[model samples]
Target: MRILEVEHLSAWYPSGRTRRQVLEDVSFTLDRGQVLGLVGESGCGKTTLARAILGLHRACAGVVRHAFPRPQMVFQDPYGSLNPAHTLLWTLEEPLRAIGTGRKERRDRAMELLDRVGLGPEYAGRYPQELSGGQRQRAAIAAAVIARPALVVADEPVSALDVTVQRQILDLLAELKRDDSLSYLFISHDLNVVYQICDRILVMDKGRIVEENDTDTLFAAPKHPFTKKLLEAAE
Candidate 1:
C-alpha cells in the first residue's frame, strides 16, 4: 500500500520580501516498508521536502496524502531536538500523553522502547544532557517509533554523529525496517550513507529530482549529469 504520496509539491520561504522557492514540483510515493532515500547537495531541498511532508512548513502548491495512521519524524539533531530540562522519561512520556495512552501503559511501554533502542531502562530517568550523542539519537528514534506510526521521515538523522555512531544508527534503522515493516523517507546529502540503507533513491538538484532509480541501478549506471556528478563527488 502507498503509505505516503506527494505530487507537484513546492515549498517556498520569504527572504526579506522575496519569496524564494526551495522545493519545486517535487513528487514521490512511499510504499509500506520501503526506504526512499532523498539525496542531493546542501541546498537541494532535501530537508525542505521533509518539512513539507511533516506539515512543519506549508507547501506552496501540490498534494501530500499520508494514508491514515499518520507519520512521525526522527530529527537529525539529538541534542537540539530534545530539551535539557526534561528527563528522558518525561521526554518519552510526552508522545504517550499526547496520544492519550494510559499512565501505566505509558510507563510500561517506555521501558520496552528504551531497550528496543539499545538504551538501558535506567537511562530513562536521566536528562538528555546525561547521554552521549549516539545514545541521544537512539533515544530520539525510539521516541519517534514508540507510537508505531506507519511512516518515518528521517532528515539527516546521523549527519551530526561520528562515523561509528552513524553506523550504529544505520544498523538500528535497518533492524527496525526488518522488524516492524516501517516505511522511511530518508533524506541526506551523503550518497554513501544513503546507498547503504536505501532500497530506492531520488537524486535532487536545485529543488528538483534530476534523476531516480533503484539503489543498485543508480549506483551502477547513473544516467543524469547531476547524478553522475553526485557519484563522482562521493568517490
Candidate 2:
C-alpha cells in the first residue's frame, strides 16, 4: 500500500524581504514498507520537503497525502531534538501520553521501546544530558518508533555520530523497519549513509527532484548529472 503521496509540493522560506523557493513541484510516493531516501547537498530543499510533508512548514503549496498516524521525525542532532530537562522515560512516554494512553500501558510501551532500540530499561530515568551521543540517538530512535509509526521522516539521523555509532544506528533502524514494517523517508547529504538503509532513492537539486529510482539501479546507473555527481562524491 502507498503510505505517503506528495504531489506538486513547493515550499519557500524568507530570504531578505522576499521568499525563496526551497522545494518545487516535488512529488513522490512511499510504500508501506519501503525505505525511500531523499539525497542531495545542503540547501537543496531536502529538509524543507520533509517539513512540507509533515505540514510543519506552511509557506508552501502542494498536496501531502498519507495514511500514517502521528508521523514521527528523528532529527539530525539528537541532542537538540530531545529535551535536556526531561528523563528518557518522559521522552518516550510523551507520545503515548498525548494519545491519552493508560499510565501502565504507556510505561510498558516506553520500556519496550527502550529495549527495542538497544537502550536498556536502566537508562529510562536518566536525563538526555547524561547519555552519550550514540545513546542519545538510540533514545531518539526509540521515541520515534515508540508508537510504531508507519512512516518515519529521519532527517540526517546519523550525520553527527561517529562511524561506529552510525553503523550501529543504521543497523538498529533496519531492524526496526523489519520488525514494525516501518517506512522511512530517510534524508541525508551523505549518499553512503543513505545507501545503507534506503531501498529507493530520490535525488534532489535546487528545489527539485532531478531523479528517482531504486537504490541498486540508481547507484549502478545514475541518469541525472546531479545524481551521478552525488554518487561520485560519495566514492
Candidate 3:
C-alpha cells in the first residue's frame, strides 16, 4: 500500500528577482516499510523536497498526501539541530510537551528511547555537546522516534560521520524499519550509502525526478542519462 504520495510538487525561492523555481513537478508514491532514496547533486532540490515532505516548506503547487501520521526528521547535524544548553532529557521533552503528552509519560518514553538507541540512562542528563558524533546522531534518531512516528525524513543522516559510524547508524535504521515497520524518505548525495539502505531509488535533477527503479535494477540498468552520470560519478 502507498503510505505517502506527492503529486506535481513545486517550490520557489523568493530570493531571486524573479522567484527561482527550486523544485518542479516532483511526484512519487512510497509504500509502507519501503525506503526511497532521493539522490542528486547539490542544489538539485533534494533538501527542498525533504522540507516539503515534512511541511517545513510550503509547496508552490502540488499535493503531499500521507496515509499515516505526520513524519519526523533525523537532521544531518545532530549537535546543530539539538539545543546545546538543554540536557538530552529536556531536548526530548520539548516535543512531547508540544504534542501535549504528559510529563511522566514523556520522561519514561525518553529514557526508553535512549536505551533503544544504545545509550544508557546515565546519558539522559548529559548535554548534546558531551556525546560523540555517533551517539549524538543516535540521540537525534531516538528523539525523532520517541513519538512513534510512522515515517522518517532522514536528510544526509550519516553523511558527516565516519564510514564506521555511518554503517552503524544505517544498521540501526534497518533494524528500526524491521522492528517498527517504519517508512523512510532518506535524502543523500551518496550513491553507495543509498544502495546500502534504500529498497528503491529516485534520481532527482534540476528539481525533478529524472529516473526511478528498484535499487539493484537502477544500478544495473540505468535508463536516464542523468542516472548514468550519477553512477559514473560514484565510481
Candidate 4:
C-alpha cells in the first residue's frame, strides 16, 4: 500500500532580493514497509524535501499525502534533537502524554520503546549526556517510534557515528522495519549506506530529483551523470 505521496512539491526561502527556490516540483511515493533513500550533495535540497514532507518547512506548491499517523523525524544530531534537560524516559513519554495516555501507561510505554530501540529500561533514567553517541541516537529513535508512526523521515541519522556504531544503528533500523513493517524516507549522502538499507533510491540535484530506480538496478547501472559520479566516489 502507498503510505506517502508527494506531488509536485516546491519550497523556497527568502533571499535578499527575491525568493530562492530550495525544492522545485519534487514528487515521490513511499509504500508500506519500503525504504526510499534520498541521496545528494549537501546543498541539493534532500533535507529540505524531508522538512517539506514533515511540514517543518513551508511548501510553496504541490501536495503531500500520507495514509498513516503523523510522520516522525529522526535528525542527524541526536544530542541536538533531544531536550538536554529531559531524561530519556521523559522524552519517550512526552508523545504518549500529548495523546492523553494514562500516567502509568506512559511509563510502561516508555520502557517498551526503549527496549524496542535496543536500549535497556535503566537507560531511560539517564540524560542525553550520559549516553554515547550511538546510545543517544537509540534514544532518539525510540522516541521517534514510540507512537508507531507510519512513516519516518530519517535525515542522516547515523552520519555522526563511528563505522562500527553506524552498522549497529543500521541493523537496529532494519530490525524495526521487519518487526513493525515501517516505511522510511531515509536521507543520506552515502550511497553505500543507502544501498545497504534502502530498497529504492532517489538522486537529487539543485532541488529536483534527477534520477530514481531500485537499489540493485541503480547500483549496477546508474543512468544519470550525477548518479554515476556518486557511484564512482563510493568506489
Candidate 2: pairs in clash? none
Estimate, for each residue in 93-127, the C-alpha lDDT of model 4 and write its tens digit: 99888888999999998988788888888898899
Tens-place lDDT per residue, model 3, 35-70, is 999999989999999998878997377999988775
Q: By descending TM-score, how would the candidates be arranged?
A: 2, 4, 1, 3
> Model 2 Cα displacement at 39 (Å)?
0.4
Model 3 residue pairs with clashes:
none
**Top TM-score model:** 2
lDDT string, candidate 2, 140-177, tens digits: 99988887789999999999999999999999999999
Which pairs clash in model 1? none
Report the Cα lDDT for residue 15, model 4.
95
Off by over 4 Å in 2: none
**Which of 2 and 4 is the better model by TM-score?**
2
- State the lDDT at 110 in candidate 1: 86
Each prediction's number of clashing residue pairs: 0, 0, 0, 0
lDDT of 1 at 93: 80
TM-score of each: 0.97, 0.98, 0.95, 0.97
Question: Candidate 4 has what TM-score?
Answer: 0.97
